[model samples]
Every structure is written in structure tokens, then in C-alpha cells.
Target: MTTCATELLDKLASRRAIVAVIGLGYVGLPLIRAVAESGLTAIGIDTDPTKIEMLKAGRNYLKHTGGEWIAPLVEAGRLRPTGDFATLAEADVIVICVPTPLTRHMQPDLSYVEATARSIAPHLAPGRLVVLESTTWPGTTTEVLKPILETSGLSCGRDFFVAFSPERADPGNAEYDATGRIPKVIGGDGAEAREAACAFYGLFVERIVPVENAATAEAVKLFENIFRSVNIALVNELKVVYRAMGIDIWQVIEAAKTKPFGFMPFYPGPGLGGHCIPIDPYYLSWKAKEFDVRSQFVELAGEINSAMPRWVVDRLAEALDRSAGTGLSRAHVLVVGIAYKKNVDDTRESPALRLIELLESRGARTSFHDPWAPVIPPTREHAALGGRRSVPLDPATIADYDAVLIVTDHDNVDWSALAEARLVVDTRNRAEREGLAGPRLVKL
Candidate 1:
């Protein structure tokens, strides 16, 4: 099987490949940026009017997605943003980066991917290559997406090429560029499809490795994320155990890393978040049940990780009582950070949302301040709870809250002022790193 990079490099120089991208998410947008910068004729498709409009107007939706990179491509007419699936018929290559988010029940939700495939199926054509970049279960490309894509009477591998290349995009990391990331995996339903897909990706990516099959590529992505899920769970479990012994888990891990051999450090926090570590392992767990294999480590980690929000609430309750001699109820609890992870604005599966809900349920008035996120959107779980609103992040306002719970650690947020806060519950060690001496605060 030829790698996507080789196939792309072979054709992209001739300006022959017409690229179409589905879903303008954190994964899709950067990919389109790469495809455009590679000199490919790129078309970006999205159902979201807001995102589509933003791209068309040369505005970047994501904070890390700068307009400087996309504006030039759009101006040159090499890149386009469209809502029409009819344009897919004109594509030589199509990349699907739609989200495969989890259901509220923690089940694999393939609605977005399936819906996007169906939208493109009607326009399926010969000599076209379709690549699935959405991280999903192993059988999804073969069993789920294949059937949907072939519905247009297009026989895959014969009339069109189909492949699965799990996206390795790490949002908000400056170290890895869209095209500079090394070694993307590609697997196809057949050799021709595999070669074509690889050649297509080779145009943009620096390295591409063609795997044996789609299942291999899918499993590779699963293992990559599941490793983090399990390790973070280990640290989370250790954090809980060490908390009882009054030892900081972060310090313990940092000290362990002092031994240069046999240890890569992972941290503990309120809970898991975003699209990968928190959810990817569960897809394997679900698949394991079908094979009658119990994934105990994965399940146990999910359980412990899930319980972290409540544990955080307990810590916050204790902090409030210790600081004010009263319960958490009726306390003006302010969340210092709300994003799913530090330094990024993504809140996909953030446990901070759950902490806010738990706090409010206990009769405590809750508010949040995230400079990156001036406004919050309504979530499926918190829609009736007034969705999300903004709060003041000023110094005077910092003293107004009874206790400040730091869920995320953005670099821009004033750490000095936060350390001086009257009462603080540091989940991410943001306050501790500030070296605040007086009014020592609690840490999770």
C-alpha cells in the first residue's frame, strides 16, 4: 500500500488533485489549511452556517486557528468554503474529519460521521479517494462508513477509493505544524485505494505509512489515546490515595521523573476531558464486550475518572469549610478556568462542566471566568440550566467570590492575582506554581 503522502506528492505537483474536506472542526480546519498551503485546490464543507460563514468571510473560528494562514489561501482562490455536497463530485480527494463524540450514556455516537458520509454519497464519482480522518472504532470504516459511501451505486476500490487515516491532530500545540507532523497512517479497502489515498496525503504531510488495513490504523489511534486514558487514571487513582496521606501527587510524579530511565510522567486533575483520552478507550471497551473480553483496566479508569468531579466537589466543600467555617452551600463559588484542558479553548468532554453542575445542585451559586471563552454555549446536559454565561476576571472581582476553584491553567490568566485570592482550590497546581506563601490554599 502506498502512503497518502506519496500519492499526493505524485499528483499535487501537477495541480491535478481537487481536495474536499468535510467538517470544519479542530481537526478539519487545520487539515484544509495544510491542503491549501500544499498548493492543492481545497474545498471546505460544513453544515454549521456559523463556521462556514466564518471561513468564507476569512475569519477563523478557533482561537489557535489564525486567519493569517487561511486568509491567503482564500484570497488566492485555491481554497473555498461551501455547504453544498454537489461540489464533492468534482473532488479527486475527500477527507472526512467529522467528530465521533460519545453519547450521554458514554456510548460511541457515529451520527455526525454517518450523516456526513451520506451527504457525500450521492455525489460519489469514479477515480475519487475518500479518507476518514475521524478517530473511531476499528470496524467503522469497513462496516459503518463503507456501506454508507457505496450507497450511490459506486463500488469502492473499483469506482472510487476509500481509506481510513486516523487524525493525529493535537489542537493548540505549536510544536507540531499541520504539515510538519511525522508519519500519518493510511489503510484502504484495497491496494489501488490505498495507493491513491497515500499519494493524496503525501502532498501535504511530511510522512505517511500505509498500514495493512483500515482496522490496523483504527486500532493504532485507539491504543495511542487509551494509553493516556489508563496512565492518567493511574495518576488520578494515586492522587486520591496520596491525598489521604497528605502527599502531593504532582510532586511524587515529578520526583519519579528524576530517574531518567523507565518513566514518562502523567498528571492528575479534576477529571478527563476533550475528545481523546476521556472517550477513545471506551470505543475499544465497547468492542471488547462484543468479543466477550472484559477490559477491566479501561473500565476501572473510566469509573475512577468519572468519579473525579464529585471528588473535586468534596475537596471544594472541605476548602470552603476550612476557609469560611461554613458549608459549600450559599457560598459564592467561582470557577477560575472552565476549558476541558489547559491552554486550549476546547471544552468537549470537560469535567469542569460537571463540577459546576454539582456545585449549583448543592445550593451554591456558581460562576466562571475564562478569558479565552467570553461566552459559553448551551450543552445537551446543561441547556435548561441557562447554558453558559460570562463573568468578570478582574482583581477586585477575584475577592468577591468566596472560593476560587482552578480547573484549567491558561498561560494568559493572571497567576499572581489568583495566588493572592482569599481562598483557592487548585486542581491543576496553577496556584502552587505561583509560590504563594500566605493563606496556603488546598490542592486536588
Candidate 2:
């Protein structure tokens, strides 16, 4: 190992390393919490002043963070929150947890990652280890981040170190936390960078898996989300076919899962959502085009998942037509659960927004009710839907809508209350799971 790597490794091993985590959103906050909880001094850096102010006041904006847990850490001075990139100069280790979203053309938009890299470049110092926890296509660490940081006259693996450790953050998942419980997959620019990165992560993370290089580590993240996309696409296709054959896709999946060894069950939803499943597969598909290869499977999966909102809307329209003998033009639909998934406030790439848009485009009046998302926040694609508040889920409110459509199956919702509605379209099979069945119910 080089002297820089050796020094970083020593600082990490002795718990003397000043860890700076950038982009203090879902991934960054949890990571910094884990670092501080592990007895390391963690500096939380973000470009968002609101997040900085919230952290400074010991407030938790995210629901999954277990409520104001950062207060004690902030009081103890173990967690320092700031909005300055210049603070990177004081950090022995820096982790970038910025978003890697797609562009309007569905191609990988690395603007956030690029901007973050540029911000860190000027603060680059020898013996400081930089690790990227952002999910992106292969070679981003070497081809994108390393090149940007080297512009500061510091060479990776020699004067400084660089690594890619993809963020596997599952918000609203109470079972596991990514920071200290989940296994971390790390790949470095070189042997020394890899060693230093692994050693640093090994201090907080439970297990560390070092890969061949930065590109391989990047590929691992893409592969994980792509695997989910492909499997979900299979189930989604099966959902359509089985529905045609008068079969319940959820029942088939539940039975197939009984024979544990081979089949891992991937549930069908109205559409794909969340930061990773809806977005990461496209990164690889876009990257494959550069090598003159077409990721037909990945692209096909994207097409199916993307088309799901329309399919659900069509199903709802058909149900409405059958129940009320009137089309969607005169219908006032109540959409249940606007969040991407169950029990989470995150709405990134949520299909429910598209569902609402498609419904309105088809002349149906739409209102939503999500306990988590009381009011829709501004999103890149669904900015027009922002500021819309969640409607009441009471029986009286359910009685008013032409039909109640369950897009997301949040456990907190009173599923039985839908019996009061004249018509109900269930995309998630939530009604069935909740023992709710009647002539008014339609399962898509």
C-alpha cells in the first residue's frame, strides 16, 4: 500500500477518521448516523440548506429514521451537519451519496454525481479517501469521479484514494439498515485504493466485499436492480396472461413460493417505483449501447414496467364501465396510496403519479389518499401533481367516489372500508389479502 492508503487505513482502524458524508438525503443521513453511532466523528454535508437547518435543529425529516435520533448525536458533537463543500478538507474519508437519476430521454443523468465530483475536486487533499455510494453505470468511479478529482492535482491510489460502494438503501424497511448491518460491496481504482476503502468501510459496515475494480463494483449495483426489473417484468407479464386465463397471479406466486429452493417470488404491482428498481436498470441499458450492444431484455422490461400505469387505468375504466354503465369521463376516482411503495413517503418514479395523469388525461377526476404522503411534493417528472393533498379515507369519503383504486397497498389503510364504495379496482390484490371481497370489488 502507498503512504496515503496506509495513513487512511490507520485512521479508519483507530476510529480517528473524520468521515464526511455528502448529499444528506435518505442514503446519506442513515450512513452518517451509522458512522456516528459507531463512535466515529461524522460530518453531514449537503447542498440543501433546509436539510442542514433541520439537522442543526435535531429534527428528522424522514419517517424511517425513527424520530429525532440525530439529536443526541448532534448534542454530543459526534455528528456535524453542514452545507459547505470546503469542509471536505477536514475529512479523512468522504462518501458521496448523491442521486443518479435519468434524463428526459430515459438515459442516465449523471449531473448530480458530476456536480458533486466537481465540488469535491477543489477540496481534494493527499491521504484523503473518497468513496462513491451513488448508483450509476459501470466505470463511473474511474471514468467520471476519478478524472474530476485528479483535476485537483492529486492522483488516486497514490496521493489520494477512490472507491465505489453502491448505496443499497431500502427506506421504510425496518428489517435491515444499510450502514452497519448490510454487506458493503467495494471496488477501488487500484490495489491500495481498494484496501483503504475496504478497511474504512469495514469499521462501520458489518461485512465488506472487495471486488476487482471500480467498474465491477458499479456493475454489481446495476446488476442487482436489473435482476429485480427482469423478475418483476416476468411476474407483471404473467399477471396479464394469468388474468386472461381466469387465474390469480398472486395465488400462483404464493403457491410457487412454497417450493422454496428454486423460485424467489417477485410480486406484481401497478408499476415499478423507488429510486433503484425503476431507475438503475436503465443505466446499464444506456451503458450497453456505448459498446454497440442492445440490452433487449432490460429495455423490454422497462417498456413493460413503464406501460403499467396505462394498463391499470384501463382496468379501472373497464371496471367502472361494468359497475356503473358509465365510462371514466364522468367518474371521480379516489386513488389510495400515492407513495411509490407501501409505508414509505418516497415518491421517486412512483407509478401512482402516472396513474393519476393517465386517469385525468382519460377525463377521469382523480384524488389520492396516502398516510405517508399527505401532500405530493415536487418531482422532476410529476411537478404538476405537487401540492395535491391526500383526501380522507373514511367510509363517507369512499361513498362519494365513483370508484376507489388501490395503487399502493400501505398496511395502515383501512382496506375493509372500501366495501362502502360502489366500485373498487384493486391493482395490488390488497383487498383479497385483507379479506375484503364483494361484488363491488375488481382485482386487476
Candidate 3:
């Protein structure tokens, strides 16, 4: 092992290493909490002053991450939040958890990651470990980050250790926590870097999966999300085909899931959503083009998934016309649960935004109700949908709408109350499962 790798491993083993986690958003906050909870000193660095203030005050901004967990850690002096980049020099281990969003043309935009890399490169010293937890295309660690870090005039695996470890954060998941519930996948350029990366994460993470190289580790994250995207696209395509044949896709899925083997259930939705599913596959597809290979599955899945909002709007308009003799124009439609998934406030790439826009363009007046997200926040893609607040749900409110569209199946919604709608278009199969059967109810 190299001198830097050996020193990092020794510091990690003795719990003497100070872990600096950049970006105090969804991914970084939980990781900082985990490191602190593991009895290790963690300093959270972010450019957002509001987030830094919230963390310093021992409060939590994310609904899934409780303030009770953070208060004790802050009080014990194990966790510190700051907006200064100068503190980067004090950390023995630096973890980048910034966002990697796609550009307007649906290309990989690594501005946040690149900016963070440039900022910290000046502070990187010998024996320090830098691990990137941001999701990106393969070769990002070597091609993009390594060169930026080498600006410090130090050799990477020799002067300092570097690795790629994708963050597997599923917000609002009750069964999984960032600390140890999810196995961490780590990789680096050489054996010393890989071993040092694994050993560092082994301190707080319960399971460490060391892959062949950094590129493989990056590909693993994209592959996992692409698998979901493709499978969901398959079910979504089937939902349309089954609907035209006067068959219920939800019942078919329920039956197919009964098979003990060879079948894993993936349900259809209004469209693909969340930070990963709707976005990550494009990164892989974009990367594949460099090798002169076309990723047909990814392209087809994206096409199918992207068309779902229009399909759902078309179905809703037809349902309205059939049930109430009203076209989409001037129709009062209420959207239930605007969040990407159940019980989470995160709305990145949420299908509900597209559904609302499509409905509005068709002259349908749309309103939404999400218990978690009281108001639609500004998004990188759907800035026009911002400032809209969630409408209250009740029997009277349900009866007023021409149709109630169930986009996200949040558990707290009163299904019984929703059953009273004039016409209900259930995209998530929420009504049928609740035993609400009638011509007034429609499923996609």
C-alpha cells in the first residue's frame, strides 16, 4: 500500500479522521448524521447559508430526516455545518455529495461536481481521501475529477486517495437509512485507492462492495436505475395495451406477482419520476454514443416513459367526455398527491408536473393536493408550476371536480373520500384496491 493509503486506513481505524461532507442536502445530511452517530467527527460544508444555519441550529429541513436525530449529534459537537470552503483543509476525508442534473438538451451537466472539485483541489493534502458520491456517467472520476484534483500538484493514489462511491439514497423509505441499511459500492483507479476507499467507508457503512474500478462503480448506479426505468416502461406500455383490450393491468400485475420465481413486480404510473429513474438512463445512453453504440432499450424506454403524461391526459379527457359529457376544455380536474412518490416531498422529475401542464394546455383547470408537499416548489425543468399550493381534500372538494386524477399513491389520502368524486381516473390503481367499483371509477 502507498503511504497515503496506509495513513488514511490507520486514521479511519483509529477514528481520528475528520470526515467533511459537502452539500448538506438530501444525501449529505443523512451521511453526516451517520458519521456522527458512529462516534466520528463530521463537518458538513454547503454553499447554502440557510441549510448551514438550519444544521447549526440542530434542525432538519427534510421531513424524512428527523431533527431529534440531528440535535444530539450537534449538541455533542460531533457534527458541524458550515458554508466556508476554507474548512476543507481541516478534513482528513472529503466526500462530495452535490447534485448532477441534466442540461436543457438532456445531456449530462457536471457543473456542481466540477465546481466542488475545483474549490477543494487547493486544500487537498497528502494522506487525505476524496470520495465522490454524486451520480454521473462512467469515466467521470478519472476523466473529469482526477485532472481537477491533480491541479494541487499532487499524485492521486500516491499523495492522496480518491474513489467513486455512488450515493444510494431513497428518501422517505422507512426500511432503509443512509448509515448502513444500504450496501455502499466503492471503486478506485488502483488497489491502494480501492482498499483505502473501502476501509474508510467500512467505519460507518455496514456493507462495502468493492468493484473492479471507478468506472464500474459509476455504471452500477446507472444500471440499477435503468433496470427500473425499462421495467416500468414495459408495464406502462402494457397498461395502454391492456386498457384498449378492456383488461385491468393492475389485476394482471397482482396475478403475475403471485409466481414465486421469474417475476418481480413493477407497477405502471402516470410517468417516470424521482432523481434517478427519469434521469440516470440518459447518462448511460449518452456515454454509450462515444463508443459508437446505440442504447436502443434505454432510448425506447425513455420514449415510452416520456409519452405517459400525454397518454394519461388523453385518457382523462376521454373519461370526462364519456362520463360527464364534458370535454377537457374548462374541465375542473383535481390532481391527488403531486410528489414523485409516496410520503416524500421531493418533486424532482415528477410526472405530476407534466400532467398538470398537459391538462392546462388542453384547457383543463388543474389543482393538486399533496400532504407532504403543501406547495409546488421551483424545479429546474418546471419553473412555471411553482407558487401553486395544494388544495384541501374533502367530500365536497372531490364532488366539485369533473375528474380526480390519482398520480401518486400517498398512504395518508382518504381513499373513501376520493371515491365520492364525479369521475376518478386512477393511474396508481389506488381506487380499485380500495374496493371502489363503478362506472365513475377509471383505471390506467
| Candidate 1 C-alpha lDDT tens digits along 248-349 | 888898899999888999999999988788888988898888899998988998998999999999888887887777689978888977788767777777
TM-score of each: 0.95, 0.98, 0.98
TM-score, structure 3 vs. true: 0.98
In candidate 1, stretches whose alpha carbon ends up further than 4 angstroms from where it belongs are 1-13, 385-387
Clashing pairs in model 2, backbone N/Cα/C closer than 3 A: none
Better of 2 and 3 by lDDT: 3
Per-candidate alpha-carbon RMSD to the true structure = 2.4, 1.1, 1.1
Residue by residue across 97-177, what tens digits does model 2's lDDT show? 998888888889999989998999999889998899999999898889989999999877789988999888777677885
- Model 1 gets an lDDT of 0.83
Q: Candidate 3 — what's its lDDT?
A: 0.90
Candidate 2, which ten residues in sequence have the lowest lDDT sum? 170-179
